[model samples]
Target chain A: MSHEIPIDDGYLDMDLLRFTTAGSVDDGKSTLIGRLLYDSKNTFEDQIEAVEATSKKRGDEHVNLALLTDGLRAEREQGITIDVAYRYFATPKRKFIIADTPGHIQYTRNMVTGASTANLAIILIDARTGVIEQTCRHAFIADLLRIRHVIVAVNKMDLVEHSEERFNEIVAQFKEFASRLNNIVDMTPIPISALHGDNVVDKSTNMDWYEGPTLLYHLENVYIGSDQNHVDARFPVQWVIRPHSDEHHDFRGYAGRVAGGVFKPGDDVIVQPSGFTTKIKAIEGFKGQESEAFAPLSCTITLEDEIDISRGDMISKPNNPPKKDQLIEAMICWFSEDSQLSPRSKYILRHTTNEVKAVVQEVRYKVNINTLHKIEDDKTFTLNEIGRVSIRTSAPLLFDSYRRNRTTGSFVLIDAQTNETVAAGMIV
Target chain B: MEEERHSYQVNHLAQLESEAIFILRETAAQFERPALLFSGGKDSIVMAHLARKAFHPAKLPFPLLHVDTGHNFPETMEYRDRYVAELKADLKVGLVQDSIDQGRVQEEKGPLASRNALQTVTLLDSIEEHQYDACLGGGRRDEEKARAKERFFSHRDDFGQWDPKKQRPELWNIFNGRKHHGENFRVFPLSNWTEMDVWQYIKAEEIPLPNLYFSHDREIVHRNGAMLATSDVVVPQPGEKVETRTVRFRTIGDMTCTGAVDSDASDLDSIIQEVATARQTERGTRSDDKRSETAMEDRKKEGYF
Candidate 1:
């Protein structure tokens, strides 16, 4: 057997796309991921052989591709995905990271964790069942996490006779439900059969009436350039680079990933909390002085003035500085199974390289994820529960709403005593 | 076409590099005493390169700890010494032989016996002796089934045991490095990188590797359907014939368990092409993982990197 190099010299120019899969249980989520890996030639011979042996041992007809995932022993024995399993595959055009998360309702935290860093989300809908409660919950979490691109894959189309009518009906149903979400910028629906490999990697010949790009095509060509916050200039200083060497003496640079907007030499910036204003003298990148630095680029910057700035300090434009306040209202997903979130619960909140002690002032309401309704009376938050809460920090936090900037708007709460990450919060 | 590629739109290599640099800087800022777990392998070499770029002009804030198995290829050891000197960073070596001498671990005795599993004890002892709250590993999720469920910031207990079922939910780019005393975390900067990505990045960055990775003629013996080099640690077993063959290692591990594949691709481009067309996973030739179906999982649960 011969295989072509799916990539070439221009492979270095290929961009990366991180996405996550979400939907109801038994929707063939894992199989869709396996099919993607296999059809793309990313699956190796040993992995295939292993899966085949497992399938044969389990007495299954046709190789069970889902076994390729489900990495844990218990997960494989139970034939289910328990936690998030990250898988990587690359075509000549782009490199893709797939966060295959479990779809059980009790695994809401898994979906939230997987969706946190995803640039896009693939929500699988069973062609026969159409949209269900789990589907809405997945869409809700995706929207809440502010994922810009969403692909509504109407999977298992082979079971529905590859009917164009069924695909359209499911797309319509998803759009109607997704209309309530405000953060999703682009949503494309495609009919696919994850098992039979229809319109996933290659276009489906059975569904001739459906005329859309295959799932792989859309993934490779999606417009993700505008997904970042390029309008707001925010830099959260993560580390201070002082070489302490004679050759680079008198050099002090604030190093951090550009959280938002474009930063350039001579740009006027303000240091939060201290309210010190300074001008950027130079942007020191590894290659040398970069003309401009934008969101997600890790670079070091030197200021014109010798202002004392340390980790967790936010640098933004004076014209549009981030909101500075001690009281924060946000929606949080409870992730701790050992404890529950109650009023007056103290935790260490970390946001944008800064850490602060915070107290849960009040739990306003619990969100019924399936129905997207507020349960006002049930304010307690347990494991896998999400709710709106008000928190008061010991020190003021600089930020924007999660809708505006994902980096500056997100934070994680660590249990003070347990040191475990208990909640993931998005500033509202 | 050139104008279409915006500055904000970074390529996959640059993106992975940036992510790694960010993680490195975070590790520096979070941990009081952190160390990079260097194995003189390609992954750790790439990781050290990233660390250099992360804090340019400034020496690496942490030390590079190599848990020597005492059965390594000579080229790897030489490369480790030279690379450490070039970076001007601190180097710490934990020897499995020392662990054996100290009666902490017993050496296996057989044709298939290897010090591969014994390195875990030495590694844990080094972490404890050095009080490293965080150890940056070159572990990538695509390398093994157990690694697929790994988080960027993987937590460990006081006994250095990993509880996969009880991992903290890592969200976005914000990592929680807060831990109690005696407990440490294993941070993987290349958790999302695949073997192809690693090679592509190495080629793009022009990073150098040990000579063992290139094709060369070596005496080898066949065992368990893999080509094992006839080194001092791994000699010919009874009824096994030793032959000279042109081969190269897909991965760098202990000389006892690592297997070389027949290949003529000696350079970066050809090696990448070979990797692209190769029918086996990079770890497929590793005898350590071939021991059982869930060998990696079991070892990882026992605090293996």
Candidate 2:
């Protein structure tokens, strides 16, 4: 299915990317967004006027860039961002979605929510202030969320006159600390002055001693093709679209976004759990049939010969079928306000498009993020804690390791009572 | 706007679009009765575009609801009619004049009177009359600070009140549309998009919009530092002078409420260029938002979209 094919629809030619930003209140996450919007010229006249009005109303000397993204009224009143304000800004290089997450400790759930779908996690650090505990906490969450790419932005370089010595010190310290992270890899460091527009879009001659892709350059050129799972073919059914409209009543195509791998119209595929084999029939989508389909593209597929496939059934090539098992081991970020991981606690686990009842079978060792070590004695996982655990589901889930494919490996724990999603887990 | 998609992990605009489409489908799948709020503005137009794409090759299952303040630019209504007819979607209009006639709401009696705020009452009455379970709106969080705290699936009580603290926690892609009798949900698919994104998307998609969005020669007068077009609703006073100038509206609402800005950006590219260097916020022209710091929040609490 993964073949070079020529087709038209030039605009949809773009691939999508989601990223999260984690930084302390002082690190200027909001300011960075404002700078990006302001420099990239994404902010509208009305919004800029509102920010200026609010800035004057608050009696601020300079235009408060942070005020631009701090959306909550209480947040603006308090002069701090409290919730995750997902911001979308596109450039010619790529369309970027910035999940501006809170750096405050109490808003850990918001951070986790932002981190869950991000392929890259940008950790902002105030250059004047070197590596701090807050930075460690954010980096830990990025790793825990399995974000393959990490950009450590040493912001506010203008404050220190773009000091190479200070930048090197922080970079060295960060690199050493990140190497200790068991889950983290692909660490990239860039010195930036978000306030002064240094290394954000244009390279700074002031930092000639440093040699690396500028912040914008890296964001524009980073290899994110491998971010998706193309090896493990897993499909979770969202909903079956029959249309049933005049033209096509016999269209019994299973519709869902491909969670991993590639599929074609005539490939040998296997339906999981049923142990059924069938030839591919048609790889259909909103734009109609195509020669190939890949991960994250929502489309419909009709099997060559009718087979038993329902909402939870996984689809993959015969050779690369994901392991189907009732017992699954995973690392999790607990996000509940009222619930904690306990033995025999039953919850609805929504993996991909499949929802099944899973119970906490055993309390696994909790890792100390600060020290990057496993705390075997501390076995209980509480809210906002990252830990290794095992779950036994009533039905088997076909999945790939989260490291291999985020969509296939990830699942959400929802409270059966309020129907509130409590935690996000990634299969280890 | 960024043309390249793979540079980042997810296309922000596409992610936002997909999320919007997902919400639209969920609205269609979950509610037996729903309506799309159409103000003929870019945001609402953007929502309509997404809705059309959500279930392409099929007509929009829901009707377009526009709360008329009885003080609207003639061009907006004309454009609204054309767009709906083109897409084959039903268009529903709730007139504030009827609400005033029925005494459901009393019009403000003063020089600076505006139906902008009063449209909420007629809107609520229409929703109740129609029993619409869900109302798809084009409100963006970046439009205002109060809106920033709003969830994509904002819940409203029977009386149409929005409580900041009472809002349900939005997690991942899961949106709770549950409500009791007389209660309805206001869906904002464009909540994450900024005004810039809307313009950029509109340009990229080549979506048709009202001529009011583009600059044209119009006679207008300055009042309270705002450029007000000389419509039937807006009359020039003894102190104010009306003059013809090239102006366009960034946001279109009640004629008494919407304000125009001086510009010559009649084409898509020029409009984007003007938006890129704009100095004032979009809502700066609307007198409604100036009522108070929490005006939008309070209005929203009252079931105002």
Q: Write the per-residue lDDT of candidate 2 for residues A187-217, one digit (tens) a residue.
A: 8899998877788777887899878987767
Show pairs that collide, candidate 1: none
Say which candidate scores most in lDDT: 1
Expressed as tens digits, the lDDT of each residue in B1-305 for candidate 1 is: 33235546667777777788899999999999999999899999999998998898699999999999999899999999999999999999999999999999999998889999999999999999999999999999999999999999999999899998888888888998888889999999999898998998888777889988999999999988889989888889889978999999999999988999999989998998998888899999999998899899999999998
Per-residue lDDT of A77 in model 2: 71
Model 1 spans > 4 angstroms off: A1-8, B1-7
What is the clash count of model 1?
A: 0
lDDT of each: 0.90, 0.76
DockQ of 1: 0.59
Q: TM-score of chain B only, all predictions?
A: 0.97, 0.95
lDDT of 2 by residue, B1-305 (tens): 22123232344445556567666766776577999999888888888988876665456878999998878788888888888888888888999999999998889886568887788899899898889988999988767767867788888888878877555555445555656678888888887777766876776667888999888998998877788988777888888877999999989888877788988898987877776567777788887887776788778777788
Which candidate number would show the highest TM-score if scored against the true structure? 1
Query: What is every candidate's C-alpha DockQ against the true complex, given to 2 decimals?
Result: 0.59, 0.26
Candidate 1, residue A389: the lDDT equals 97
